[model samples]
Target: MNIGILSDIHIDREHPEPNRVIEGLVNVIEQRGVAIMIIAGDIANDYERTLHTLHLIEELTEIRCLFVPGNHDIWNEKHPDKTSWEIYEALKAFSGNLVNGPVALPNGWTVIGDIGWYDYSFGSSQYPIEQFDQMEIDDRVWQDKIKTDWGKSTIEMHRYFFGKLETQLSAHRSRKIILVTHVLPLSDFTVQRPNRMWRYLNAFLGSKQYGELALKYSVAYSISGHVHDRLQQQCQKTVFICNCLNYASQWIENDDPVSEIARAFKTIEI
Candidate 1:
């Protein structure tokens, strides 16, 4: 089986006619001979559009599509009345969402996923934890600070996901695990810049504990997004992958939507 993986499509950030984005995805999936599509995160900024696009991809390609919610995916910007948790539940309600539970695959390989929150472990040591908590740097606020109201500190949220994911990993410890998350688990996947602004931004990018968990549970593939960088590294038994089809302006290799998506689209044989 070919498992197609990619993250941070950010459809709303690029295509004016959303159908074009959906069509591009379908075309790529077909061309790649993907048996199952696993989107790591950030399909779109709004939950509704995100869900709609996932549905369209599954509908058009006729393949099982699974995904975790990125920070942007659960944003309440368009629907201010809904809390981030509400948006989360809404996205998880979809049958294809991996957030619901682990999906068992053939030959003892199982996949588990979640929108793991950042724990400020990725931040620069120069900044205090207090500063990371502020969720602002250089007078610019991290968008999650504005768009999401989880009603909990970032640490609390990270702990919640950590515990939940640990339980899932423990249950399937004997199987070949493929762990997916919206946030980067390893610093190797983070921005390589040593500048202050990036360091501050890096604080919210991800957590080292996730990488720790992958090793603890002996995960075969630790896949994630939100860093907007395409990086892959092998540490111990796990292969960390971040294949983000970032903002259109950030695209350097390709200009066409289908080509961009195709270029970032990665596959693993199961």
Candidate 2:
């Protein structure tokens, strides 16, 4: 089976029309001959755009698509009446294929995932809780704190989702497991030599415990996003991949919407 992976499309950031960007993405997926698509996260910033993107892909390609929400995807500022958990439920309803739990694919692979919020364990130990807490006053403060209502600390959410993943992996021990999340699972994938600001902000990248769990369960592959930088690394039997399209402003020369989408998406045969 050929599975296509992509993340952080951020359709709302695309210029002119988001529909055009979706058309390009569809074209690239068709061109790559991808039977199943795994979108790691950050498809869009809000609910409507996220649903629209998913609907367009399902309608146009009719390929089996599995996705987990990015932090941006659950942002609640636009819809203040709803909590982030409610928004997540709405997204799951919108995309019938959303993989918050384990799903057995016809290809004999088991897919399981969630938004996978972070626990600040990715940050340097030199920084105390006060330092991390004080980040709110600096530019490093993430919008997630204000936009989403997880009803628990980031660490609690991380442990909760990790528990769900552990249960799924245990249940499907004999099958090939493909774990997907919106945030990077390992600290190795984080930016290298990041500045003070970026270093402080790294707390939200993800938790080291995810990587540990992946290795413990011997997952075949772990796919994630959140860090815009691309990464591919092997930890024992598991392969971790982060393929992000990032924002238009971050794109460099010769980067068109279609090319960017194609470049960010990686096809793997399993």
Candidate 3:
């Protein structure tokens, strides 16, 4: 089977409407003969819109669309009345959501996913966890601080997610695991820029504990997003991938939806 994987489309930020965004994705998925699509997250900022778009993809492409909700996807931006945890539960209940349980393939392969939270382990050594706890610096705040409220601390969420993921990985120890997370797992995938602020902000990018889990579980593929950069790296026995379409403003080369989708989209045999 050929699986299409990508993330961080941020439909609301990339386009004023979902039509063009949906069209772009469908084109790439069809052209590549994808049997299924795995979106790691950030399709849109609202849970309702994100769920709608996920369904729309399946409706148009006629294939299963499996996904993990991105940080942006769970934001109460549009659904302000709904708490982030409420939105989280909603995404988990969606039919195609991997969060409910593992999806098994015929070839002894299993796909497991979650909107994994972040720990400050990725922060620069210069700053203490206290600083990252502020979730702001230089008068700029991490959107999640405003758009999301996990109702728990970042590390608490991170540890909670880790426990759940570890359980899933343990049960599928004998199978080839395709672990999907909206936030990254390894610091190796962090942006390479020398921006000083990234030193503090990187804390929210992901957790090193996930990297450890990958190694401990002997995962075959680790897919993630949220950094808005395209990166692929081999660490030990696991292959990590992050491919994001990002916002239209970041489309420095060309803003054509189809073209950008093709550029960020990736397919792999399972």
Candidate 4:
């Protein structure tokens, strides 16, 4: 079976013609003969658009689609009455293929995933907790802190999801597991020796605990996207993949968004 993987589409941040971009992506997946497609997250910052995007993909393509929510996807800006967890619950109901639990594929692979929020573990030791807490001092105030209300600290939410992931991993111990998350799982995947700005921001990228869990469970393949840079690497028994079509502002010279989507949405045969 062939499975396609892509993430961080960020339709809200993309060019004006998002539907066209989606159509282009669908064509690429169809041409590749992909049976299933996994979108790691950040479909849109707006909840309704996220649902609309998923519905659009399902409506336009024959390939089965699976997804997990990104931090941006759960932002409660417009809906002040709802918490991040509440927003996640609503998203789960809307996303028929939300892979928070175990999903057995036709090819005998078990897929498991969650939003996988981060802890400050990825931050450099040079910086202290106070710095991360007071994000404005270093100009690192991410909108996630203000928009998302999980009713728990970042580390607490990370632990909560980690426990759920462990349960899924243990249940599917005998099968080849494909784990997915919206945030980076390993510090090794961070930009090599990041500058001062990136170093500080890395705190919100991901938690090393997720990588440790992947290793502990011996996952066959792990997928994630938050960082716009596309990368893949092998860590022991697991191959980690991050494929993202970030905002046009982040694109390098001569990089077309549609073409980049075609190049980044890799089809893996299992």
> Per-residue lDDT for 48-147 in model 1, tens only?
9899888888888999998999999999999999999999999986787888999998889999999999999888998888989899987889999999
When summed lDDT is taken over every stretch of 10 residues in candidate 2, the lowest stretch is: 132-141
Of candidates 2 and 1, the better by TM-score: 1
**Candidate RMSDs in order:** 1.1, 1.6, 1.2, 1.6
Better of 1 and 2 by lDDT: 1
**Candidate 2 deviant stretches above 4 angstroms:** 95-100
lDDT of 4 by residue, 1-270 (tens): 888888898888856678667976888888988888888899888787888888889778966789988888999987889988788888875544454467788757888999898888887788888777665436557888799988787778889988888888898888999999899998877766888887888888888888888899889888999988788989999999888878867767734667767766787889
lDDT of each: 0.89, 0.82, 0.87, 0.82
For model 3, the superposed segments whose C-alpha errors exceed 4 Å read none
Q: What is the lDDT of candidate 3?
A: 0.87
Task: Return the top candidate by lDDT.
Answer: 1
Steric clash pairs (candidate 3): none
Which residue pairs in model 1 clash with each other? Answer: none
TM-score for each predicted model, relative to the true structure: 0.97, 0.95, 0.97, 0.95
